[model samples]
Target: MTDDLDTPVLDNHLHLDPRHGRGVDAVKDFVRLGGTHLLVVNKPSWHLGVEPDEPTDFRPVFEETLDAVAAANEVLPGRAWPVLGVHPGLISRLVDDRGFSPEDARDLMQGGIEVASEFVADGDALALKSGRPHYDVSDAVWAASNAVTRRAFELGAALDCAVQLHTEASEDLTDLAAAAEEVGLDPTRVVKHYAEGRLAGLTPSVMSEKDRLERAAESGEPFLMETDYVDDPEKPGMVLGPKTVPRRVRWLLEAGYDDAVRRAHVETPRAVYEIDTESTLNRDT
Candidate 1:
């Protein structure tokens, strides 16, 4: 997938689980495909074989993600940013399997978000990843999850960074935007991961499939693209492949959607994450 252009190609949401998956090699796959940058989000704690009994246990998980970013930067320096946080799905596991009360689980997850915020504060990460469960959940569990999500928004506001959300799919994000506003976070700074379409108002890091990318480009609206590459060995490329973003960008460029590709890959990331992806990716080229 190598191309002549030095245009920035970023995958907004991705994971590299070394112990259980391809890890940095998967990152190499992306780099080989012309991907210039990645937002390497941490996997679920359980995926790392960590059953956290407390908040600090998440430190190793976050550290692993940071290490992966560091390694990836060695391949393409200044190309990957760490987005660390406790996965919202942990709430269900705590409440269902561990038999913790919903309130207690909320507190635990909030504490995990707090721990993640520390990494952001120290400049080890660029943003946070959080959201409520995407599957059917009890009312109390849902309430607690929302509380935890709010805490993530609050932390993001304090850190002056973005929060990438993994929630139930929907074209409209009115309630999600309101939650960010209520927590004093800019709604525009909240990135809806795995988004299927233009969210009513909030930013969407749409998964980088050809059709979806085409539609987003056709709309002429501000948005980002991603592979959401889980890097799981069993269900490899669960959401999309590591090479999907760059491969699709090549197709888009050939299709004469140059302006839209630039807007999505460089401009939108700069606007949302405050990172100059254009300069960052083009340097040394």
Candidate 2:
């Protein structure tokens, strides 16, 4: 077990699929490691399937993921939140493998955005996740995917929820704030998930690596940390483990960077997700 810290850490992004056989045990382990909060994301390819015969419907997957979050809260109430949306890669998968026409693929994405909005409006989710940029796709598919992402931003703006982006690591987001402004969404509410370097005016939920986390800390930028933990048995802790953020917090504390630790694990999450761990924990108690 990792040594506990005085302050609690939040893993802002993680995949807690039961298929991996890491259900309540995973949540219990995380709490033991001093992880106080988690943002569980739904990836259709992970839960459902990529093939046509498999259930292509997204609603069930979304609901099931939400249920997973609620179940985690039952085990550790107010400690887990949900993020629901259609992955940007799913758009290309439908067009290329499933033989969905570009128009149909876009329409499906639009439908996903609508469902995501409904989930947020109903308080089932903390944010809307979309806008993964695929650089290798044909220009037509690329444009269509981006249009779907833009629509997600528009819906998030209308409903007052944040939109998390899953884009290429090298992609520049200098225009993200301006684009969001044009669509009536606050720039700060647009999160760049699995991010690396700092964007000019965007919030990044950065991957937990020593070098990356150190740089982000030294830069004194406002950011959140995530392991992007896939929780696949085959690839156990693919990106990083569930305990990553808390371990990083221990490192920060040892290095005497208390303020940075608090900002990354506490302040930024509260500001972005509008969640207060202390208050939630108090209520739970």
Candidate 3:
């Protein structure tokens, strides 16, 4: 049903990894399903062996992400953008498997921040990504993770791009906003990715869960929605498919929450991530 709709929506977070063989099909399918824009993140590297050197060494992954954006634009110009950073889970893996000392890990993370900034500065990325206090990590690793996350926020301040945070669902985000402010980044620029509840006083990029989606819509709070679609063939549509957000919007529209759908699909994304929805959708048409 969403495939026939013309309403503009942005899937603010998704991974279009070639490793998974989704490639352009993923991007095309998303566009066909009424997704007018996307923010493609670097593929998580925890599955790869530990990266022990400077973030510049991660150039290939960042390049791949850019390539995905390029490919999407080729299919539908201005349809996609990139978000670059070292995944927080990869940080924990490096500490556990590679025996990277805390200081060394911090150094590596700083390198990542530098790399992310370069991409944003070059207009190749719209934001930086990182997470603090990843629950899967040990306390020591979590400390290192938070340090890296803070550095990312600092970079966001300098570069004037948003920072997408991968964090535990429903966690309090006041401290995160405070950290952003401390680093001179506007708290509104810090987006909590994969959020599942009402993140009072913070912005969230939410996923598709009917009850949670309903709750967020009813709250009349400003927020964005995402599928977090992994694009893995092994677990096809694992979190959600490309069409999920559009279908949700359809529900919102029918439920008399048209303004909520617009806020979530258009206004929040434009304000938080700087997407030009009008231009993107116009190009598609």
lDDT of 3 by residue, 206-228 (tens): 78777778887887887888888
Off by over 4 Å in 2: 1-3, 50-56, 282-285
TM-score of 1: 0.96
Better candidate number, 1 or 3, judged by lDDT: 1
lDDT measured at residue 152 in model 2 versus the true structure, 0 to 100: 87
lDDT of 1: 0.87
Model 1 CA lDDT for position 223:
90
TM-score of each: 0.96, 0.92, 0.93
Candidate 2, position 107, lDDT: 83
Which lDDT value does model 1 have at 259?
91
lDDT tens string, model 2, 1-285?
534567767888888777555866777777767777788988655346533323235677788788789878865533788998888888777888779987788888878778767888998888988875546888788778778888888998898888888877753686666778889988888889888846665798888887777777887878888988876777877789877787888887887778878888778878877878766753232
Model 2 steric clash pairs: none
Q: In candidate 1, what are the lDDT values of residues 38-90, reduced to their tens digit?
A: 99999999988888888899999999999888888877633899999989899
Best-fitting candidate, scored by TM-score: 1
Give the candidates in order of TM-score, highest first.
1, 3, 2
Candidate 3, poorest ten consecutive residues by summed lDDT: 45-54
Q: Is candidate 1 or candidate 2 better by TM-score?
A: 1
Q: What is the lDDT of every predicted structure here? A: 0.87, 0.77, 0.78
